[model samples]
Structures are given as structure tokens and as C-alpha cells.
Target: MPSNPTLLDDQPATGAPPSSPSATTIGDLEAGLDRLQSQGPPARRDLVRSLLPVAAVVALLCVWQILSWAGLKRSDLLPGPLTVAASLADAFADGTLQRAVATSLLRGVSGFAIAILIATPLALLLAQVRTLRAALGPLVSGLQVLPSVAWVPAAIIWFGLTDATVYFVVLMGATPSIVNGLLSGIDQIPPQYRSVGTVLGATRLQHTLLITLPAALPAYLGGLKQGWAFSWRSLMAAEIIAVGGSIGFGLGSMLQQGRDLSSMPLVMAAILAILVVGIVIELLVFSPLERRLLRRRGLLTQGAS
Candidate 1:
């Protein structure tokens, strides 16, 4: 049958017109989402964030100085910032503090490096093997809670007053942390990730390198940070106890010497040096790396850590 032209014209269009409000609304929604996903905080906000910590430190120093001024009778016991700074300068000029820092950093970094090497593979094995993880998992967690200082006496007995003793202590302190961190990261992975990898015929190594490791990076980094802390603490404990050993004078030994000489400024200087080193490392290395990683993942929000 022939359709009338008016009847055909009266039929409604199947789709919205190109310039319709609904189309425009959908387009606007998409653009908004894109902007939200891509944009971060402004540069001015970042600058303010960078300055905040420095301001806090300055405030703390001011308070410390004021307290020292008020406590004139106990000035020798609680040396002012100036006294500590002067002691640091003197130690630096005489090469004492420099040597101590160098020795400690070298030992801590090297020992931590070795600990990573030993722990990564061990953790991987335990993570992959059900029986091994079930057997050793509790022990690994327990080790994290154990005081690293507890190992000093045993380390000395096993290795005597040698660098080996210090390294052993550091290993004992750091390895468990790394192991636990990696395992925790791996455990947190959704089971579907493994299933996807398996369906794609990925080898075990490929699965780990491409899928598991990247997913677990944040946790692994956290573990590494904790491991470094444990390494530094263990090294200090060993150095303080085994000062006469071949390990040379480290920050802990420097502290011990200050005590032996009954010099409060030197003691405070040593303590400050240790703190500065820890802070410097965190600010220079881990903090930037963490920010970068988290930003890449879109996990770091503006004005947040």
C-alpha cells in the first residue's frame, strides 16, 4: 500500500537530533569526568605544602631555644640549640662526626641491601608455596615484634667483635620485615588477578613480574622503609655494645664516647645527627618516591600526604 506523504512526515524520529539538549548533556558529563580524572592540585597549594614542614621545624627550634634560655641552671644538662650546633661544627671540623656518619650509613645501607637480596626470594617462595608459608608465616610475623637489640648478645657471640657481627644484627633485624611486607602485598592481591594471568598462559615468573609485583609495589615499599628503620636501629645497638670491635666508630659509638667523656653537648649533637640523617633520608628519597608512585596511581589526593 502507498503511504501518504503527511502520514510519513508525522512519524517520530528514532534518535535524538545531533544538537539536542540530551546529547549536549551527555557530552558535558564526559568532559567533566575527564577533567576530574586528569587534574591535580594547583602549584601554589603544593608550594604551601612544601613550606609547612620547614615552618614546623622552625617553630620547634624556637620553642627549644626559649626553654633553654629559661632553664639556665640546667643549661649544661639540656644544652641549647646553639650549644648543640657548635658541638656539631666542632665534631665536623675535627672529622669525628663525618667519619661516624659515613661508617654508620655505609654499614646500614650495605646490610639493608644484603637483607633485601636474602628476603625477596625467601618471601617469594613462601608466598607461592602454601606449605612453606603456613609453616614459617607466624615466625616471620613474630620476628617483626621482637626487639632487634635482643640479637646483639647472640651476634657478638657468633661473630665476635667484627663487622660481621654488625651485619648479622642488621640482617636479623631487616630480613623479617621485608619478608612480611612482600607477603602481605601478595596476599592482598585478588584471586581473579591470578586467574586472569593463568588464562592468558603467563608463566609464573611473568605473572609475578608483570602482575603481582606492580600491584604490590606500595606494600613492598612500606616494608622496605620499615626494614631500613630496623637496620639503622640494629646497627646502633650493635655499635654501642661492640664499640671496640673492628666496626670503627659509628654514631652510636660517638654517643658512647660523649657519655664516657661526660659531655652533654657532644651527646646531644650525636643524637641530633642521628635524627637528621633519618629525616634527610626520608625527605630526599622515600617521600618523593612515594608521592610519585601514589600520584601515578591516583591515590594521592591534593593537600594530602
Candidate 2:
């Protein structure tokens, strides 16, 4: 046969060789594969990390059950998970749990809103004025370290065992955190961003709203989250200790009643409910908001050096 016309010699192999793809096609396939592989690790890691915490909680519950079974602790003093679960079901059936949750959530949200409204302007003022910052910064930072319960005494004195007292305590507990957060966020903003704003002839208000506020959102959000935590804690403390008719039947009051009655199961149920509510608020609202803001600005993954 006439030298068996070589495969490579036949029309330059039309497109790709029989055993190999074109360089561009190979590159595209490699890129796709790399993307797929890259995506797989994060998904697997997230699943594993999520499962690990749940596993640990389950293990702790098992240990608790074992302790109860072994008679290492009195059932009344250290009720097992089953007892607490039963109490939760009973409370739900009686509608007490719903009312308590609603009461606590209302207080938390109201106090948090007031704190944000007050703190935002104060923070802006402090950030822009060195004298104001000097006058207020230390106080704000100091307030962060103070326990929310400490405000209960002063709040009661000023507001006299009313819902206003509880609100006052909550505001005191939360405002410092919000102010400090905004102040620090402003401080941390890059000077270069400010310079760009100045170069663009941005007004003071425009610079703050468009440049500083957006850039410092992460820190501000951080403060808001912490402030909410403080507000919740303060409200609970006030409700539990103040013992006034105006406070209503919040989870904190229920917890206090449980303690007075020596009802371990009820106490446990109240505590669990509080924890669950905090987690739900964070997960449902703040977490998604924070993620959206950070992702939109491409700041979530930006590392500080």
C-alpha cells in the first residue's frame, strides 16, 4: 500500500487527533473540572463541620442520660434530655411557650430598635468630632464590659419598676456596643477611600452615607448583633428580677417562676427556648443580611494583613 497515508498527513486531522483534544477544548474541560473539584471540597467541608457540632451535642445528651440512669445526679436537680423534651411539649400544648416567646421577642426587638436609632447618630457624631470621641469613647468601651444586669438597679431607681425601666436597662446595655462598633468601623475605614471621596467633591453627608457607611457596614453590623445580645440579656434580667406586673409573662419570668417552684424541667425548657430564639433571630435575619452586605461589596473574603 502506498506508504499507508499517515493519519497526521490526512487533511491535518480535520480537527483534533483521535487520541487527543484541541488545546482550547482541553483547556476548557480542565477549567470545568477544576471548578467542579473546587466546589466539592467546600460543600463536603461544610457538611462535615455542621455534622460535627450536632454529633457533639448528641454525645453530650447521651452522657447526660447515662448519668441520670446511673443515679449520679438526682432527676429533679439534673433532669435528662427526655424530661426537658417532655416539658417543652407540655408547654407548647398549653400555649405558654408561645406567649413567653412572643413576649421576649417583642421586648428584644423594641429595645434593639431604640438602641440602634440612638446609637447611630451618636456614633456618627463621635466619629467626626475628636473631642466628642475623646469624651465618649472610653465610656462606650467601658460600658461593653459591664454586665447588663448591673443596669437593673439604676433603671429601677429611675423608671420605678415599669416597662420603661426594662426598656431603659436594655437601651443602656445595648447602646454602648452599637456606638463603639460604629466608631471603630469608621476608624478602620481606609484613608484612601476618604481621599477618593474628597477628590470627587463629595459633600460631608454624601461622603458619610456613600463611602464611609458602606465601607464600615461590617463593623456596624457586628455592633448591632452584639447590641441585640446585650438588649436581650438586659431585658431578661430586668423581667426576672424586677418582678412587676407590667413586665408581663416573658420567658424570663417563666424561668424565675420555675426556679421558685424548683421545677428543673420548666427551667430547662425556658433556657432552651431562650437559646433557640436567639439562634433563630441570628440565623433568619442578621446572618443573611451580613452575608449579603459582605458578598455584595466583595469584602467577606478580603483578609486583613
Candidate 3:
């Protein structure tokens, strides 16, 4: 008989059969690698975006140094970047800068914390009680616009020329902003969310803590940030006016002393120190916090990256 074709040979070929397990796994890994490769450029772009500002700052310092070398401005008035840097180094070596920074930071942070502690509960209470809100709302809003420096006189009267006076001024400046911010956040919360909470058997406290607090956190944090700024400014103003034998040496005191001595570089140094501290705190603390909260809520955009 003629040789019979085996079943395998007799079957008409459509195409390659399904891959073996090893081949399939290899193909999957290749696809995954391709996907990752495609995603790499965007990550790099984001990194560049984050680094661009730092590069710009470095460039600015270079420009400033060049201008200083060329004597573009009076050293006494404009004070070359190098001179400022030297002054900063000197201050650090003398231990004056560290002590001043610590004193100012302590006053600002302590007062800010106290303000938040006072304002948060008050905001919650006002948010829940219509009567309390109606009674206090106008006052709180008005207080936000009042200059913190105005409180210095009253604080001095109430607490004298001690640290307590400085703390009082900071509290007055920060508390209103915090309370108003929290209240505004609460007000913006949708009634639908409250209804849903009620339907889900959430008690008043549970609803406030779990649902309302989380929902209002962004605004609350914003208020807290603003409050901190106000507290810092207020504390500085208070220190400038109230510094005496009893009050510790602070950045504001340094500025005052520089003015007394007519040392422009020292005055500028104190101002620069204040500015740097504010920026560092905002960048290291509040900015990250805001970014994290906003990202979790999907409110932050790619541009924000």
C-alpha cells in the first residue's frame, strides 16, 4: 500500500499554533517592557519640570555674583551676593543666626499651633450650629482682613512685653483665618453628602469626623497655611515693637539692631533670613502636604507635577 499520511501531516495549516508556556511568558514580558519604555519619557519630563526651578535659582545666583563683581550697585545699599553670603557665614560662626532662627521659629510655631487648636473646634461648632454661625460669621470674616500688626498694641497691653505678648499677637493674627477657612470648607460641603451619610446610619459625630472632615480637609489645610503665614508676620511685627530686656533676641530684633547701627548688610541679612525661613517651611512642609492631599483626590493635574 502507498504510505499513509499521518493525522498531523494531513491537517491543513492555518497559521502558527498557540505558543508554548515559555514562549507566551516571554511575549508577555516583552509587551510589559515596551509599555514601561513608552512610559519612561513622561517620568523624565516630570523630573525635569521639578528641577527647572532649582536650575533657574542657580542661574540667578550666578548672575548676581557677576553683577557684584562688576560693581553694578553700591555695596552698602545693594550689598553684593558674596558679601551677603559672607555675612551669613559670619553670623553662623558667631552663633547669632542659629539662635535668632530658633527663637523666631519657636514663637511662630508655638503661636500657630495654639491658634489652630483654638480655631478648629470653634469652626466645627459653628459649622454645626446655625445660631452660632450666624452670630460669629461676620466677626470671623471681618477679623481676617484686619492687619495683624494692629493686635500688637492690644497684646502688649494684655500680656506686657513678654513672650506671652508675642504669642498673643500671633494667635490673634492666625486664629481668624483658620476658623474662617474651616467654616468656608464646611459651608461648601454638599447637602447630598450629608444625606448619604444619614442614610448610611452615620451619627452626627461620625459623619463629621469621617465624611465631613475628609471632604473639607483641603480647605482646612489651606486655612492652616494662611494662618501660619499670618502668625509668622504678626510675631515678627510684635518682636520688632516689643523687644526689650526681657524678650529674647530674635530675627526681628536683629533687624532692629542693624537699623540702630546703620548696617545695611545686617538688616538685609535679617530680612533675607526671614524670607528664606518662610519659603523653606512652605516648600518642605505645606507644599508637599497640599500636593499629597490634592493628588489623592485627583484634583492635582499633570502640570502640577
Q: Candidate 2's residue-wise lDDT over 95-145, tens digit each?
A: 999999998899889988999999999999999999988987898899889
**Which scores better on TM-score, 1 or 2?**
1
Q: Pick the candidate with the highest TM-score.
A: 1
TM-score of each: 0.86, 0.82, 0.82
Error of 1 at 155 (Å): 0.9
Off by over 4 Å in 1: 1-45
Candidate 3 to native Cα RMSD, angstroms:
8.0
Q: Which candidate order results from sorting by TM-score in descending order?
A: 1, 3, 2
lDDT head-to-head 1 vs 2, winner: 1
| Poorest stretch of ten by lDDT in candidate 3 | 1-10
In TM-score terms, candidate 3 sits at 0.82
Full-model lDDT for every candidate:
0.88, 0.85, 0.86
lDDT rank order: 1, 3, 2
Candidate 1 RMSD computed on C-alpha atoms after optimal superposition onto the true structure: 5.4
The alpha-carbon root-mean-square deviation between model 2 and the true structure, to one decimal in Å, is: 8.1
Q: Tell how far residue 28 is off in model 1, in angstroms.
A: 14
Q: List the residue pairs that clash in candidate 3.
A: none
lDDT of 2: 0.85
lDDT of model 2 at position 91: 91
